[model samples]
Target: MATTLAEFEAKVLLDQTLSTNHKSIIIPIELQEKEDSLPTNRFNKLFKLLIIYCLVLLVYPVYLGYAIYWHNINSINISWCEGLGFLLVVSTLVYTCLCYSFVLSPLVDHISFDIRFPGSMEKVIQSNEVRCAVSSIIILGCIIFLIIDTQDDRYRLVSAGGILLIILFGFAFSANRKKIVWRHVIWGIFLQIIFGILIMRWDSGRDFINCIGSKVDTFLGFTDSGSSFVFGYLVDQKPFLPTKLENGSLAKLVAEEINNSTAVKNIVVFKALSTVYFFSFLTSMLNYWGILQWFVQKIGWLLQTTIGTTACESLSASANIFLGQATTPFIIKPYLGQLTLSEIHAVMTGGFATIAGTVLAAYISLGVSSAHLLSASMMSAPAALAFAKLFYPEKETSRTKSDKISIKPPSEVNVLDAATQGASSAGLLVVNITAIVIAFIAFMSFINSLFEFFGDQVGIHNLTFDSILGKLFIPLSLSMGVEWNDCEKIAKLIGVKVVLNEFIAYRELGLLIQNEELSPRSAVIATYALCGFANPASIGIQLATLNSLAPQRQADFARVVFRAFISGNAACFLTACIAGTLYNEFTYVQL
Candidate 1:
């Protein structure tokens, strides 16, 4: 009544179609049957372990909630944003276990099922004209609302006009304006605009992004726990200023003195950048667990589909949000040689227009909003593609267009090995940031000194680098919708960022905010504008990384690299313009 294993194998060998089941899923049916025929004892052992692991995952969240409740009961201030994000991260781990729970059972035969979509629905889903129509309606609706709101207050129109100016500036520098793809450009702008509205104007979206940001801020703080033990008092200054001190006024004065000391500030700066170690470890672990790669592929796929970029360009662009410019190019290392000139430009511009998560803690330490940084990182993803296409339209056919590419997995032996390797690589970044800050500051000081001498000789008093840059970029600052009085001040920071680095610019911004020199709206606009890597140093960083990957194509893409530099700068400015548009003092503050 039953066939032997050899006979079943012979049948499968004779008929190739039998290798797959009706669902089109591969199933070596008889071989799986042979495996199932083994003793149940071995299978039960694994199933028991998996069930136990799943139980632990389910119970852990209860303890987490209890811990939060206990802390709150003791009057400890816990942000709802961080709490929500922590719970979401835990829930994700549990969901992962439930999905893999099928492994606890043996493979089964496929059952019959039917799924179909209506013809009209399928047609609508595939129609680009429909997409354009819907997008036009949404954009027009927003513009109309802004215009109506501006009837009572004319200032609302400034930011809307700024958005147009930024786009026009990109169009002015387009390398091949005739070949620009309007559909790709439209979708790109739509994504950025939608993201801006959701994150800045919508309540739920703001909370969601804040949750992610708060969780990240809390996670990176774990680095200080380790640093406190190794570095001693440098990280333990908080403990020295307890409220229980008998002489409260004297203790407050002493604490202020301690905090403001140059030594303390330098120590804080060092500790901030040292966070790269923990972040790298986290990144490596996530990659080992396939979490990082999974995110990269999904986001990459979305960008590739919507913006119509090649796989290499989209993946690297998404990767730049998490990974730094130095390593992001390696995601497409295998295809670097095959990328078109425009694809290469897109990838490089992306690296320019975003910062890495590893350095986010350092920026936040300089008093920037973590939520703004995270959203800017996401917003710049689409903006880079849009502006890059405008700057250098792709003239050649992409080899991997619309095709998904696999991420390169880590080569480390295990999770522990990943941790070791990750921490080891962080030293280079810490040193790089330190060297740049120290050496560049000293060099800039000398340059400013020379400028001051020449300025006094010419009857100008106190003229320096910022003054020169402030004068030079006043027009750009005005275009960002800043008040006329604040234009020169904001322009100076923009010039500093473009000429030097974002770190210096952000440091100055933090100081200005502390001194109450910049208004809230101007400070917010400056935050978005300065939140990119579009400095001169980045162009070289990208060129060196890309050249190492594909040396033969280096010469062809050299000039294109400079074009991407401009695109990257414009992309960041575009974001600043959007921020100016969406941020309403009366509405946002009231909300």
Candidate 2:
């Protein structure tokens, strides 16, 4: 009887229902004494649909593999990398299936049906048993590959193992639940493939993207001017206006001088630029200040253009969270209360996957190459949206009206209000940045020192964190096409990004570049690897920000935020790998 009902339910879902627009149908099962009629036509049609869907998935992986191989034709001679790239592309699809099979479908069921399962069995399936199982198997495969990679250190494998362990635990917590649905799993994979293709082609036309980027920058002038006013007021002691910094031929000359000049040789220009940077920082800070919330709202109005630009390019929700996790979304505050779960997920994922405009300069100072930061920011946006939506499938909710946002003047009565807010905000940012960086560096140093002592005592002379990380995560990195010889350095770089932030990692990369420690290929790989905010500290920051906004959901936010963090990190890493693999042929060009 139960078997019959299961079949009936499957038939109903497969036959006449399944479209997103008309999701009102439900398949109910009944236990009966007699046999019931079976619809052979419906069954055949359903089977054909399933086959077509599967075939579509198969095509994507093939296309992606061909793309990677074709792009990197000149650099790699071995056909194995092409096979491996295809496998990874397929793996991504499989991972997407498992994610939706276990994670998203359950969420959709809960939101759409208000069906919450309290028992362990249902909860386990809903949480992600299939996903975890698949992830674990992949981890084992990676471990086996590492064991055989005797010529190379095993850091990437180790790192991958750790990631798999986390997934294993997630699986343990989510076993055989009633919420598991196989079809949505397939759908999610399709969506991922679509976005992957889109992202792969995103930067193909530099001229067009740059042209659009300039227009967006031009629109940015509105908020830029306001921000400049605050900075100019503070430094020049007068009301100031924001001006565009052209990167034209003459501007390039100035930039070159700025880059090459000794500390004493060009003090004037340096001081002026430094002053501008400080003010820009200050204005950014004030956008979130209490009395200056209105200014933020106003800036958000001007920011709509930037938002539009981002959306037009199909950037992710993290773009909203980049600078300040809490404030960026507030730029679209009117929509916050009404955002669908999918939109909110995009917002959080984008925040986790990327940094903000204010800190982007600092990352440049850290040693991250200009090309790296630019590419990362652009790539991460769409990737974040795609991953976030998959990780936390949205429930139905009201959509914000189009152009619902408008700029308004700050509520403060005078300039004093603006000044105080800007100063305080900047001060807070300075303090936060200083504290996190100092504390994190100290902790890393301590860890490194411990490893140093143990390694030296045991006669493992070159053993360091990077070495260990490389030994552990090298397979994972290699799978991303990092050279076997360079995996350890890359592993350490990934560790730095996860422990600290992309800024520090990029700074390290910059040093590596200047010192010529990396081949251009390895450098490119590292740039992609470290292009996100996927560390433990970011988890805490995100939780705190979300908590402040919806104190009641703090516990829920904390619980889910960690998962979001993992997904965010994975998305960034995967994107980096894709970028590296696809662009492998272009490395002969000097960066």
Candidate 3:
């Protein structure tokens, strides 16, 4: 054994000497041997190819069914060129996928397998070149199809093209183009379309969504019961109720109408803001019991699997659908320090892209469709991550060590303590919301007055801030499928939501719905577009809140605020696009 070991050491030393002397000759022979022994899984490769083929085959019939049904129902003439363009785009996508899976992937692996230092500049350049090539091919194919298909309806084509232009505009303004992953963008668009089809296009999907919405509405309606108990008739929409008299006689009791009554005091206080407190308290109890966390986790898993974001990012983003932006970071608070800048961007953007469940009751009270609101919140999860990545791509390596999330209960010893704390927190939110609304409304009114005075000199009698905003955002609104006549109106709401807050936008939207100012389809799109907290005010809130959680990352938080705001708006618009595309104006009746 000692002799053999000595012989092995001698041989190793001899080989080292030879390798140093003849580096080029020895390296080439070793590399050739390594290349010959490279691992290849034929079974796995064949199985994946087979699955792709099967999916394509299955989707073809569904596509045909939809096209045939739509054509028959609408009785619209289909041009041969349009049909050909659709086929060509579909074929090109499949061809690209096949080529990448079968050719490019293997070739790249064979060529670059021995390359070390994955983060080296050379590797990054090569990877970017390949990505750019693939993206260019796909984009070129889509552009060709768009040009071919647009030969018939120039107006519709222009609107569609405008939407595409908006997406490109976002990509063009990305902070880190090299870090932007195309897979996230592509999957994000696909997910939005799938959700739109499921919730807006199909009857079964609509039914499911409506049923869930009804439950949400019913749950929110329960808040009225508590409000009525404490605040009497002020919070009751139907204050009058039929009662049984003491003499075994039925009496129809009617409460006096409070709509125009100056005697009615504290109506808005009890009816609007109080409901937020009740819902928040209920949510707190659910969180303490682990119910809310369970649902958040399930949704987070879905996002993690689909978008490939970190567990912390996915959890916080998913939680935003149910909790307020200020409250959601607490779920992943411990891991905040470990999160990358992109992850932080995603968290903030996701928070801004969706409203809290506690406020859902307040919006529902405004007479918006509960189903649309719920769907919008749910869909914003993936949309937020997708757009955030596109705008501010993840450049830093993640430091998170765990995939599992364990949410600590709210800072309370008992369920009762949690409830009380939640109520107090909610009270602060109510005061802030109430004060902001009153102040902003008055501010906007003052601004409009100045605008109106200036417009009077210009001979435009009905000039206002909303009209100015409307003019600015009309192209974007029209691109989202709003009717030309209604584009300005919807644009005003969108502008208000971004410039001010979602509450003001929702208030205006409620008025639009009440007065029938917008078509049902347009209303649905606007509901989705205005469902987020992507206002200028949220930037301060996000910065303050997140900075407190991870003071070490204050610089990162500040850096991403503007990008996060843009990403949040893009997320809402993406959701709006899905809703607009799938929305059948004739079939949809406003609730």
Backbone clash numbers for all candidates listed: 0, 28, 0
> What tens-digit string does per-residue lDDT give for candidate 1 at 1-591?
256888998888767765444335535666677688776767888899888877766576687778777877898765545554456566676667556545432333254446677999879876978877866886788788778756755764677787778778777877888888766666777788789889887888888787777777787788888877777666645435435566658877676567556245347444777688888878888878778877888788898888877778889889999987888988888888888889888988898888988887788767777888889889888888888888888899888754446776788899999887888888787888888778767877888999999999999989898789999998887887887878999999999899888888998998898888988788888888988888877777888888888899889669688888888888888888778777877666311
Q: Which stretches of candidate 3 lie above 4 Å from their native place?
A: 1-163, 237-266, 401-405, 409-411, 457-460, 586-591
Using Cα atoms with residue i matched to residue i, what is each candidate's TM-score against the true structure? 0.80, 0.51, 0.70
Query: Residue by residue across 1-591, what tens digits does model 3's lDDT show?
Result: 999999999999999998787997888899988776654456668888898777776776577668767777988666422463445455666667667867897889788457556577767766868767866776576556446644553443544554466578778998889888876776566566667667876787887677667656766677777788987767764444433323333333222333334244446667867779888999889888776887898788787777667788888888999997998998888888888888888999998999999888888777788888988988888888888888888888887734456777556788998899888999899998888888888988999999999999989998988889989999889888788788989999998998887888987898899999888768888999999999988888889999999999999899888988888998898888766655555566443
- Local error of candidate 1 at 424, Å? 1.1
Question: Which of 1 and 2 is ahead in TM-score?
Answer: 1
The number of the candidate with the highest TM-score is 1
Q: By lDDT, highest first, what's the ranking?
A: 1, 3, 2
- Candidate 2 residue-wise lDDT, 44-75, digit = tens: 89999898778756776676668667768857
lDDT scores for all predictions?
0.80, 0.54, 0.79
TM-score of 1: 0.80
Worst ten in a row by lDDT for model 3: 253-262
Best by lDDT: 1
Residue pairs of candidate 1 with colliding backbone atoms: none
